[model samples]
Target: MRLVFGLVLIIGVGLAGFAVFMAKDYIGAYQAQLDAERAARANAVPTVEVFVVNRGLRYGEQLTEADIRPVRWPENAIPDGTFRALAEIFPDGEKKFRTVLRAMEKDEALMQVKVTKPGADAGVSSRLSAGMRAFAIKVDVSSGVSGFLRPGDRVDVYWTGRGASELGGGTSGVTKLILPGVQLIAVDQIADSDQSAPTIARTVTVEVTPRQVAALAQAQATGNLSLSLVGAKDDTVSDAVEVDQSEFTGETVAKEKEVCTVRTRRGAEIIETQIACPE
Candidate 1:
């Protein structure tokens, strides 16, 4: 009976030791998992909900609440003019909808500049600023930059015509820059800025001031106007640019010497005499 009791006590000690070992391993694994989760949380990027288009939208299309969805976006990477909430996008309570000004793809963030005001249509007038007017310029294949221009592009207007010569007497054919860095608001009645396909536009409308409109009207009436595409990211102001046929042919033009003459009027007869030119 004493031997059996000692064996039973020994067995109890062994069982307790085994239980402790199992508990230690389980606790160690749980602690390791908790540490990993904490590290992941610390490294996670902060995000915010932003409205994005659920499907492709084109110019002039109405944007409604059903066409958009909210998604988590990196807070630091959100684009400017992005709508953060449904109320901000639909402030009028769905009585009116905004029109798309530019084309957008699925999941693209809706921007303020990419849409028109509530109940407004996408038109050239919507793109104009205060005190600005829309003027159309005729263009052909050669003058239109081979049909590569779009609505949002900037261009330099070059006029080719006969003008008074710099040397003072006769007229000469000259090409001069009439307008620089003018913003195009529409191409052939299409105000869509996202038009990528090459189109042979017969006319392009530009936004200009009242004074500029007058100048462009005069230049277009008296000369052949051409367009030169400006780079999208270029902000450099163009200097005075005028090129004549003499410059193109690399030929020097000589100014004629001035002749001063004194005339005395006689009855029904006039006599002319050569005199020295004034210094």
Candidate 2:
């Protein structure tokens, strides 16, 4: 009887120990959750309702009530030019004439530069800034950087035409640089800011000054134009870059001469003669 009693006492003690261990574990988990909640409350910041995009938006797209949504943004973290009130984004709950000037992602804040004014169209003329002109150039697979060119990239213009050297003798076909560091405004008809993929476009428009427009127009009319993409960090100045067949093929270039000389013999005496050479 004593042996059986001893066995029962040991089993009870073991079960009691396991129950205490389980209770301690449960208490620890509950305390951890409570501490987390307290921290969240202490670090909370003030927030305000602001207008944001409900879905991805493209350039030249008209704005509507369904395209925007209100979200709680931190008061101190609000971006510049963002609209805080719904009326500011769309007066009287209407956006009938506004359009997107640039593409925006979902939940992005609405900014002044990202949209056009009331009754403004998103055409090419609207995209140009003050004092900037748009010039379109014909492009092919070889001249346009093989469909890798896109809007927002800077490029250098090259003219592949025949022209004479400064000495003015015979004309040699040469390729020369016309413009450098020009910003591309659009590819074909797409001016969206979100386009990052390679596209094959027949025509590309660039932003230039009034003088640049004249120079580009003359170069295009006289010769074939080609575009070269410029790197974001490249600072090398491109000017007077020219190459001819002789230079490219490493052949000897003939110098332009105004006069030619010939050796003649008269009565066993050597005589030198000068003659005019045709250009």
Best by TM-score: 1
Instruction: Write down the TM-score of every candidate.
Output: 0.86, 0.64
- Give me the overall lDDT of model 1: 0.92
- Judging by lDDT against the true structure, name the best candidate: 1
Error of 2 at 164 (Å): 2.7
lDDT for each residue of candidate 2 in 144-200, tens digit (9 for 90 to 100): 999888777889999999898543567778898889988887899977655888888
Position 271, candidate 2: lDDT: 93
User: What is every candidate's alpha-carbon RMSD to the true fold?
Assistant: 3.0, 9.8
Q: Stretches of candidate 1 above 4 Å error? A: 93-95, 129-131, 233-236, 250-253, 261-275
State the weakest 10-residue window (summed lDDT) of model 2. 89-98
Candidate 2 has an lDDT of: 0.85
lDDT of each: 0.92, 0.85
